[model samples]
Structure formats: structure tokens, C-alpha cells
Target: MQNSFVKVPLWLFERVVGFLLALPIPIYSSAVYGLVTNMRGLPHMLGMYIRGLYYRQKLGLMEPNVFIDQGVFFAYPQGVELKEFSYIDKNVLVMSKTAKVGRRVHIAPRVFISGGGDFEIENYACIATNSNIITSTEVLKDGARCSGPMVSADQRRVFRGKVLIKKDAFIGANATLLPGVTIETGAVVGAGVTAAKSTEPWGVYVGERAQRVGTRDSVLCPDN
Candidate 1:
């Protein structure tokens, strides 16, 4: 049987008291009166305070100076370990159970990072605008087809994989990184390139198959 006389924590009791005290008073003469107008801002303000002050401060995972822009949405199991001078830009969606972001990592606007496992961003890694870093595969829409024709008329070919943008790797704007693809360290993926495979480290990748178009100075290393 469940305990009937369960004791509530002091902090929780204090929060309840504070919320009741902050309740708005009706001012208008109508039936709804000030209840509608005043109560509208109450939820928004409380939500902001809880997320911006209470949860963030209590969690202690992110650094003090980390900048979380307005209107940014963080989903469940959100874990962010950001080093100094790292900023999460506006309208970004960072949804991960465990996400480790290194120092000076610049994440551009409207980015989405979601996965059940860990999502890591090494130091000095830059994630460009409208880029998606997802671990799971999403089913394609009906009648959706690949750029090339299928080998069999009755069957449909689907391209799915994991996406990894390594340290010092730059993902250009509007680039779609497929599953199981690793953008090697110091490599530059050209704009609008859909990388379907692991790119050579320190090489410039462009086009549909993301072929190595230009060789960087670092590619001259013995590993190349």
C-alpha cells in the first residue's frame, strides 16, 4: 500500500507557496475579467524562471557563462557539458541524453542534435546552419525516390546512416549528412553536399557522392 502521510521537501513546499502568492488578481468587469489577461503572462514567466534559473542552476552540467538563446527548445534527457565560451545559438534544438560540447564550439542557428546515445562536439568544431545530427533512421515519405533510378522496378532503394562531424571539420550550409558517415578531422564539406560515406581526412568533399575535389595542406601528411 502507498504511504498516505508522505512528507514533501521544504524546497518544493516553498515553490508551491511562492507560486500561489504570485497568482494574478482580476481587474476587468467581465466574467473572465483580469483572470484571462493576468494569468496569460504568469505561465510564461514561471516557465522561463524554472528553465532559465531553477533547472539550469540546479543541474550544474553546463557552465555559468553558457548562452542558451531565447525560444530554444530542449527535450527530455537533455545533458549538456559545455566548456568555456561555447554558445548555443537561437532557434536551436539540442535533444540528447548525453551531449558533451567542448570549448569554443560554435553551433549555428536552427541546428538539431538528437540521439539516444552520446552526441559529442570536440573543441573548435563548427556546426553550420540548418544542419541535422541524428543517430536514428527515419522512414522516407511515400513516393519518395532517390536521385538515381532503382535497379529493380518493384523495389525502392533507401539510403540511411549515422552522421559524425569530427574535430576541426566544417559542415557547410544546407548540407544533409546521412547516417553512419564520418566527416574526418580537418575536412571541409562543400555547401549542399550530401555526404553518404566517410570523407577522407583533410580533403575537400563536394558533389552528390562527395568526392574529394581539392586537397588540403594537411592531406600531404604520411597518412594520406
Candidate 2:
């Protein structure tokens, strides 16, 4: 099937809208942030839609049904994609261009996802509040290097890889998913865990360096 959305490049926006637009973007974002942070209920929902409309026009691809809550900041939204029915909660910072959120996905408040590589959250996936997902990291190759748009070009070398969260996966609160890791379908990543490796489908993982404690089916049918 043909892709339904467009991924606008950062350069393209600059070229089309000119550099003047850059100066006011942060200010506009801040105003929206403030507005969203202060309001709640119907007012907050209205603000979300308003901001979402502006973002969809300025950024690359944001589907019509997507809901972007207040205080959500994106450094480079050009490469981002928010599929249908997905909602981003408050105070989320997405600093990467390669972030893709799938349908019906719920990203709770204070979630931070960053890096230059692909960060994909599949349909029906939920990432709890304060979760950190990194798909890009700085390494000392020729010297200390950083990978991202905001960093100086020569100062740091940034390495990027794909971080995949498959369908039906549940990443608990404050969990950290590192670069190149995959949380497979129906997998449960326990709270406060740091996942450094790929997980098995339907597995239940916990701890700092997450280890499989059980399967999802076992959790659902404990008597079996």
C-alpha cells in the first residue's frame, strides 16, 4: 500500500518558509506550552487540538485524529509521524526527527524520546510517564561526539540505531529503552527497568538490565 503521510525534511521547511519563520517558532511553541500547561478538561482539549493543527501544518506528518497534549516539545518534527488515534500526553520532549508513533498509542506525560535513528512505536503500544527511549548516543570515535540537530557539527560523533516497540507492548513507568533494543509484541517491560537488549514476544521483563521474569500468558493465566 502507498504511504498516506509525508515526512518533510528540516531543510525543506527552512527553504519554503524562510529563516524568519525559525525565529518565532520557539516563541510560538512556548506560548502554546504555557497555555496547555495552565488549562485542563475542555479548555485543555481545545488547546491540544489547536496546537495539533499548527504542528501538523508546520511539521511533516500528523494524522487528523492525533491528539497532542500540552507542553510537548519537538526539536525537529519534520521526520516525525503521528498515526491515527494516537495521543501524546503532557510535558513530553521529543528531540529526534526519526520518531514514529503508531495508531491508538498512548504516550504518557514526561516521556522523553530522542536520537537520530528510528524510534518506532507500533499500534496499541503504550509508553508510561517518565520513560526514556534513546536511539542515538554519543561515542568517542575521533573525539567526543554527539548525534542530534542541536549539537555542534564537529564536536561530537553520534551513532544511531533503530528502537522498535512492537504492537501490544507495555513499557512501564520510568523504564529506559536503549538504542537498538526491540520490545516485541505483548511484551511487558516492568517499571524502573533499563532494557539494553531485544525482548521476546509476550515476555515479562524487569530490573535494571532487564531479564525475562515470565511470559505475558503466564501473568494472565497464573493458575495454568
- Best by the lDDT measure: 2
Error of 2 at 68 (Å): 0.6
What pairs collide in candidate 2? 145-156, 145-157, 146-156, 146-157
Model 1, TM vs. native: 0.59
Look at candidate 2 and tell me the lDDT of residue 74: 77
Per-residue lDDT over 1-224 for candidate 1, one digit per residue giving the tens place of the 0 to 100 score:
13434445644564674444334435322322222222322225543333333324323366544555444545542365766666666566766556677667788778887654446676667888897776444345676544434334334444444456677788887676665678788888887787777888789988877889897666333421
How far in Å is the alpha carbon of 90 misplaced in model 1? 0.8
TM-score for each of the candidates? 0.59, 0.75
lDDT of 2 by residue, 125-175 (tens): 899999999988877677664555577877877778899999889999999
Residue 6 shift from truth in candidate 2, angstroms: 28
Indicate which candidate wins on TM-score. 2
Q: Which ten residues in a row are the worst by lDDT in model 1? A: 33-42
